[model samples]
Target: MGALEPNAALERLYRETGWTMRQLAQEINRVGTERGTPLKYQQPSVTQWLNGQLPKESARPVILEAFARRLLRPITHSEAGFPAPRRGSTPQPPTLDGLVDLGRQDMDPSRRGVLGVGLFSVALTIPGWPDAVGRMDAMRTDPKRRVGQAEIQSVKDMTDRLSDLDDDFGGRYARPMAAAFLVNTVAPYLKATASSETRKSMISAASLLCYLTGWMAVDEGAHGRAQEYYVKSLELAGASGDRMTYCHVLRGMSVQAANLGHGAPAVRLANAAAEASPDSGARMRAFMAGQQAHAYALAGEKTNALNSLREAERAVNQAESQGRRFGGFSSATLAYATAEVRHALGDPKGSVESLHDHFRLRDSTDRQRSKLIFSSLLAERQLQIGHLEAACTTWNTILDEYPAIHSGRIDGQVRRIPSLLSPYRSNPLARQIYERSRELSAK
Candidate 1:
């Protein structure tokens, strides 16, 4: 009839088990999130629990489990003053409740729970290490929204427009807008009534949007949030049976992971993307292989990197042989990636040559941001190998390109110029360039 002295129980448990309040809170939050029941518990929350406050409804079972594991004994709800989700304890929420909660939590700026969580193994829960590769059983769900092609097409159009914004401007400018759209608009549609076919199509479109949003998070340097978006995108892809987008999101995740110096998991995600590429067209196949090469190179796997690069080249040639011109994965993209791959593998000369090839064989579709990215890579490689004057020349081009381009990644690239030229500050040419770069960055 009365709440037990949970303070005594929790204190004894922590004292005997050597669990700090912070550790207990972190474990509770971790397990809660893993089960789609996110809690904003902190170190103090455990102290509150020890002072006789029951944990949040979603976090109770996790607290019980954490204590149980430490005690090597099962902890009852009555003992912990926090019962598990059970029959009659509370009515089960809607099927979409967890997703809604995630969206809500993501929208809440105060919830900093997942912001610190970094890259995790992509193969953790995937059976046979395959879902990361896009191999998934079609998710079967009864439809509620009468989502038709119109809804799906609207989502696609918005995606394309937002993507253009991301390409032209910076993710810093677009990420919040996209997040608001997802939480305020798309989340509602996902729960509305629809036919089976329409639901799949809508989910497919939503998956791409999620991937795009994830990419924006990457551009904004929020790797943990990007990973969350990628995971959700993959889940939506599976529900829609859209293997191609699944592979693409996996590739996206791999790219950012590599950028963060997470080589092993990056390599695994890239290989899974490659395995998922069999059903893709030649251009996409080549793109996947190229990604694998980059991942391999980052992991310091020279032989594998070179082999994957060759495979990419073969796929590209096969596509060109059949008169298929690059759309998504163009020759310029491959050339620049190859350049990076070479640089990563310690081939500075080859990297420079590949950049040369990229420019020489450039396509009309090469956007302004693409040029700046590749040129930055060229300058970076040259600078890395002590070609000070050559790097300066490349910077002149980047400086000229800087005014016309407005992208976060481009801004980051331009800011690197001063640091790159810092060692040569006494040299008039380097000083002039550094001063000019700093001036431009200030504007």
Candidate 2:
């Protein structure tokens, strides 16, 4: 091949970012690691790319993502001077069609291995409200079928049942059922003709169900799959003019990012959710502020995190005084958020205190799965503070409940029990807990 010309397009974008070559390389490596594939690119590799040497196809996405995150906008392959993706310029399928396809693949056992490979991307392009609102393509209508309130209510009721099952049993047992329902039942309802009012309501209901499915996917440790479902939920929510669901889904995505320790993306997503929130009631404010506080804490904005926490506290108080509850956010939720903020801000003792408050204030509305996860967190934090006996007691509580929940997240916590106790094995209680954990994990 002839000697290649420099990639001036990429060089221009690089200049726009104000990132040194090494900084750019470091950013790419960070994104690669976030995508579950670590890289060790140095200035030399970035120099090659700027000099017109092509990066491997896998690395191209990481490079573009680094630029996108730096520029706070979407960066296309062509814009980054990379070859167009395989699908080239073809538009994505319409919302309903895409949802059906995604759900079908999720529910299919043979196709699940492929789905599992999708990595959570920190640079994933989040659709802004204006961009997503009413952006759905005209769906094909089945003239023979027209949905009414009955159909909408049926969908809502089914979502509630599925959610309850997820809270009680675990997403591992509930997600497949949800995916199958989405493909077989909800997909058909989306295509059915209906009055404009009924159509919008049906779509809104579908959006909630989609969001719940994504939440379950998160619980099952399917982060990439969860992100896809969340995007679809946002599209549906916006199409139906349901700002509430849209904001809720965005907040859920933020929580996922924060849990995964992607602080910047978590802050961005949480702020977007709070910004897009509709007419904020006290409870709504608390819901948004609580997540914002956690995200800000994770991003290391100490002042912002504390301010957000204070705001959430005031909102929760206001909501309680008014005997009003919206968005299922309560004092208990705020306490949990406080625990997260404390933990992120490097106060494990304070975090433990807040966790205790959380459980004390928790009502029946809290999911059993959350109880287990937070209990595990409490134990880990207890261990961190040199309270080995207290930590062992907490672990015993978790073990008592662990057998009933089949969550990938909870299972991960259980797997950590032995290692967490290994240093304290000389203590009888710690040794006993460690042995118990080994036996339970073996099953």
Clashes of each: 8, 0
Put down candidate 2 lDDT per residue, 144-244, tens digits, no spaces: 46899999999999999999999998988788899988877887787678888888898999999999999988888889999999999999998899999
Write down the TM-score of every candidate: 0.71, 0.78
Ten residues in sequence with the least summed lDDT for candidate 2: 85-94
CA displacement after TM-score superposition, residue 289 of candidate 1 (Å)? 1.0
Candidate 1 root-mean-square deviation in Å = 10.8
Stretches of candidate 2 off by over 4 Å are: 1-93, 109-114
Candidate 1 regions off by >4 Å? Answer: 1-145, 278-280, 403-407
Give the TM-score comparing model 1 with the true structure, all chains together. Answer: 0.71
Candidate 1: residue 244 Cα off by (Å): 1.3
